[model samples]
Target: MTWVFLIGAILSETGGTLSLRMASKGGGRAWLLAVAAGFVAAFAFLTLALDGGMPLGVAYGIWAAAGVALTAITSRLLFHEPLTKVMALGIGLIIVGVLFIELGAAH
Candidate 1:
């Protein structure tokens, strides 16, 4: 389904971004490979979702929102990064914005 692909894109993008961070911190060959593969899969899955008829506006909005939220949460869990109240609020806003985009597309 389109939703499945979209979710995959979001997760892969998140993984790629996290791997990039790790690579930057000297995580070496494995991390670099992961970063490259993750990004490649992310874009591939995103294209599949679009091919499955998910509108660009809605798909991209959801992808960006979910990626950011998941990344922030994962960062907090994996790296003990600070996730302040402001960051939470921003994530919530992104979700709301995506919801609005989806809703608007239905009309």
Candidate 2:
């Protein structure tokens, strides 16, 4: 449950950060709302996650890595950013690392 909440927080936070970047160029009202809502939801879920049993190290690691992966993907799709093979492999490794951390807590 805590890990779930942490993942949710990571997604929302990355989403909010992306939205904010889009809004920076001036998208008017809708983008502003998206950015605001995303950030609020991100922090709320993160706080809830901490209230659960998730360790700080695990939580932060997951949060940051997920954010980086999501942000990279979004940038590539939405902003025409480049993604090399090495970057993709690195992201894959990060995903594996997160899974390992989660699995470590199971026993």
Candidate 3:
């Protein structure tokens, strides 16, 4: 299903972003390889979602929003990163915006 592929893309993108952070902190070759694989798989999954007839705007919006929210939460859990209330509010807004995009696409 398109939703399945979109979720896959979101998870892969979030993993890729987290891997990038690790690689930046000297996680070295293995983490770097993970980063590359994650992103590549993300794009592949995204393409599959679009090929399954999901609209580009809707798919990309959801993917980007979910990726940011997931990455932020995971970063805080894994790396003691700062996720202030303001940032959380921003993420909420992004989710709302993506919801609007999806709703509009249905019309």
Candidate 4:
């Protein structure tokens, strides 16, 4: 199903982003390879989602926003980074925005 592909794209993209962070900390040949591979896999899965009937604008928009949100959360959890009130509010706004976009696309 298209939804499945979309979910895959979301996960892959998020993985790729996290891998970038890892690459940043790694700073060596293995990490460099990971960064390259992550990006390649991310785009590959994204293309499959798009081909499976997800509109480019909607799919990309949601993917980007969700990826950002999840990545932020993951970083906070893993790195003991501050999850301030303002950051939480911003994430809430992003969720609302995604809902609006999805609803608008439906009409």
Q: On a 0 to 1 TM-score scale, where does candidate 3 land against the true structure?
A: 0.96
Q: Rank the candidates by TM-score, best first.
A: 3, 1, 4, 2
Give the C-alpha lDDT of model 2. 0.85
Query: Against the correct fold, how does model 2 do in TM-score?
Result: 0.81
Cα deviation at 53, candidate 4, in Å, is 1.6
Ranking by lDDT: 3, 1, 2, 4
lDDT of each: 0.94, 0.85, 0.95, 0.79
| lDDT preference between candidates 1 and 4, better one | 1
Q: Which lDDT tens digits does candidate 2 get at residues 1-107? A: 88678878988888888888888888777888888888788878888888896777778778888899999999899988889999999999999998987788667
At residue 92, give the lDDT of candidate 4.
93
Residue 64, model 1: Cα distance from true site in angstroms: 1.2
Give Cα distance to truth, residue 58, candidate 2, Å. 0.6
Clash list (residue pairs), candidate 3 = none
Across 27-76, the per-residue lDDT of candidate 1 in tens digits comes to: 99999999999999999999999999999988988998899999999999
Off by over 4 Å in 3: none
Please list the residue runs of candidate 1 whose C-alpha ends up more than 4 Å from where it truly belongs after superposition.
none
> Runs in model 4 with CA error above 4 Å?
none
